[model samples]
Target: MPLRYQAIGEALRHTIAARPDADALVVPHQGVRWSWRSLGERVDRVAVGLLALGLEPGDRVGMWGPNSAEWVLVQLACARAGFILVTINPAYRRDELVHALELTGVRALVLADRFKSSDYVAMLLDAVPRFGGADQGSDGPCSELRFAIGLGRTVGDIIPFERLLEEPDSAPFAHLETISREVGPDDAACIQFTSGTTGAPKGATLSHFGLLNNGALTGSVMRMRPEDRVCIPVPLFHCFGMVVGVLGCVAHGSTMVLPSESFDPAAVMASVERERCTVLYGVPTMFIAELALPDFGRFDISSLRTGAMGGAPCPEDVMRRVCVDMEMREVTIAFGMTETSPVSFQTRTDADLETRTATIGTAHPWVEARIADETGRPVSRGKIGELQIRGYGVMLGYWNDPQRTAETIINGWLRTGDLAAMDDQGRCRIVGRSKDMIIRGGENIYPVELENFLRTHPAIVDVAVFGVPDARLGEEVCAWIKTSGPLSAEHILAHCAGRLAHYKIPSHVRFVDGFPMTASGKMYKPGMRKAEERDPTPRIPVARGSERAIKERLSR
Candidate 1:
């Protein structure tokens, strides 16, 4: 049956009614644990406080902080109070923060004092110069912004998070239930900023029904039980962590364990062992780091049974190791964009290794997917094309940008810019991005395919394939490799010699310590491509040495 929760507030109320005493949230690092009933009360208090702050329904509330109890409270409080939560990435610097605040017209911002090197207070003050001197509930240069709330230490003229929970006698606390009842399932719940690799980020507006159901379905696919505990290491600002990680646990009445404010391999391992977490969530790169930890074998991860991996292409080898080494036999791979409530395809828990690793599984329930050519017409099964999705999970549109929204969504189908192919069984395999595709001398080369092939090399730890300018071919393949030890371009070319097509072989290979990554853990290719273009180094020809010598060297 389709999900019937009218709003996230209603969903939380139902969960509390069903299992009030059950453990709901656990933040080990913060030493915070709350049952469903306690969590509901806290959410109500925060919602009431938000209302007291003069924010109206449909107002934008920006949250800038790492994963913590306060972050989760703000997320639910906004939903309950009929406000749109704009999730600001914790890694955003001054310029990016200003853009997000101004673009979304965020009325109130709730942020931390500092996370790592980012001082949220300093950045806000710099973005809006008058912020430091602005009176309580007064508008600043941003115009729409009315106030600021600090999660840690209270900055000058900025309210603290604890103050939000302290209800004033004059405040309309009783109206919390009424306001929550008025909020509808179709109302905008969240405006997530897309990780802008090409240009400026756009806020993807998602509805309460879309996010709630997406989380529920994701949890169901992972076979989440009421007794299960889920450890989330991904950032809460991203959909992978908030929607699939937090909401998934809430939907199943499972315990949510926050390993830390940010990604920490040791913290994750320790949380799983101490909390006895049955489910874990992360991108493939996170799993790679955890598996590579020097003390990885010391951790007792026997409690881990199922989890979800998304946010980037999951290497086959990583998937296999996660199953065997991490003991996540039921680990699934989810694939989608931020516009589609982040998950439209996920592997089933009972799926075989080939299905789990080779494909991104079938279309989610109540969701329709098709592989379409450039003309928007459906292509034949197994043919490569852009993947389009139509479902309740699709976002309402980009916030206040109808022009871009119309360009992206046509006749209710959201055009995911990703290039993919669908099998007869409806399983989808992402074949690089349409924009990321490299066309060299009329040959279309999918970087993901080449990257996957290069990953099989024993010396390569990670590789990113992209197109570099070529005078004759118009464009040639370039591979940026992160290797384990000393490796030359000759060794890499020799490995790709017979396995891949001549045109697909990387024309240029450069060794790098690490690839630039987005906050969401995806390889930031546009910057790398631009840097390579600016340098325009001379290409080294492939070494044509004795086949016998190459084979003998490869054996060692």
Candidate 2:
């Protein structure tokens, strides 16, 4: 298949040359739209800047911000300089930002001046002093860290990103070819931490081949093309953004349209229509909100060839509208954690409706997918087991945590901690996260079953189920629901009564308009717990969307 690149940078060089004059990126807010040629030149200049900063091969350079020209440029610069790129989420607070940066041994950081009244420069500088050698290498001389600047209104002391580009072309990237030649498929190319809703974030290490393989394989599965333009509304820090969005674009020589903000459905819609975009890459929430836009139907979204839905489950209804109403090729449902370069399973262009709508679909061509029991024995086909995968998509293991890595990587397969059942046709249906499972009175319950059942209720908008402290059963199921119309505790319990066993039924029902969510759209249960404590009354209309159906349904 003529696959495998020397490194990501080398592959990108060929892409730029093939379409040197083609518009490779469009950043409307920055008034920046660069062709592949110009983008390549800028990448080289940034590489020179990093080299001058004394970056070594395989060293990690951190970028903490949204998807901007500078964000993409920094990643490319790392590739060109043989430095591994580490992307940190911009929406993170002080502690999270600090933990991720230090955990990955980020040698240098490139940040924005300010975004939405938050000054990143001040944020990092203030957080740096408190770092206190939290694994900052007990050895001689901790790696010297510097800040490279990016977009924003102000950056007090950091070096401006533009200044780094002022170097002469001769000094810019004369050795780019040398660095590219030195890289191999196995070289650590990039690393990004998971959202860590459960525990401290672990850096997922992606090699050049792992990333490129995921991109190439997904591109083929989704039938992405060189002329296709994908609207990347998700942040580049996420696996969906980097592996499927950026790396995929590079592999297929496709154009990537970057929005000014992480999420503005209106602006995103405008960008897609304006650029004649052929695909939309986003989490399910983004698509749901976009569909909810009052003027959403007014736009000419018929240009969309296909959609890749991941990060969270895409409701079957959403998939139907995306495919039938939006005039898309069927939306492909993808599944993988940060540990798998973000794509081990993806619905192919030829996948059936059931596979596309109900399951995360089959493993990629080079990947193996299976379910196993607690004892590591493979589960029979059609039976649920812990989902495990082994392939080029599997990460190089979490960064710098040998013990944790050993724990996660068993033999060769990566224990994904996700529960799934594979059908005879090889379609993998993800049932629930292993940790999210609730064991009550010796009965096992998966929240996804309850959540899926709740979604069937016309009044229900969203739902979450978690196991809270229980005196007798060890842990009892508690359900937090967000509804469009009024619904009551009794009504929820009754509906869940027949569909599930008594132990699986949520013992407590809390009605709230909104549940806390992470930037990538996973429900933030910890934050929800905090909010529950502060309010203690989930019975009333809280968030704006709360309706009276709960009370009425119960009164009936």
Candidate 2 lDDT over residue span 124-211, tens digit each: 7567632322343434232345554555543445666777687666633656667768988898989888777678988989888888
- By TM-score, the best candidate is 1
lDDT of 1: 0.87
lDDT of 1 by residue, 1-556 (tens): 4665568878888888999998899998899999989988888888888888889889999999999998899999998899999999999999898889899999999999998999888988877766677453445457788789998777667888898888566446668778888999999999999988768999999999999999999888888898999999999899988899877777778898999999999999999999999999998889999999999999999999999998776767888899999999999888888999989999999888778767899998888999899899999999999999999999999988999999999999999998999988878888888999999889899998888889888788888999888788888888898888998887887788667766788878878888888887888999789878787574454432345544565566
CA lDDT, every prediction?
A: 0.87, 0.78
Error of 1 at 346 (Å): 0.8
Q: Where is model 1 more than 4 Å wrong at Cα?
A: 134-140, 167-171, 536-556
- After superposition, candidate 2 runs with Cα above 4 Å error: 129-143, 153-157, 530-556
* Deviation from native of the Cα of residue 298 in model 2, angstroms: 1.7
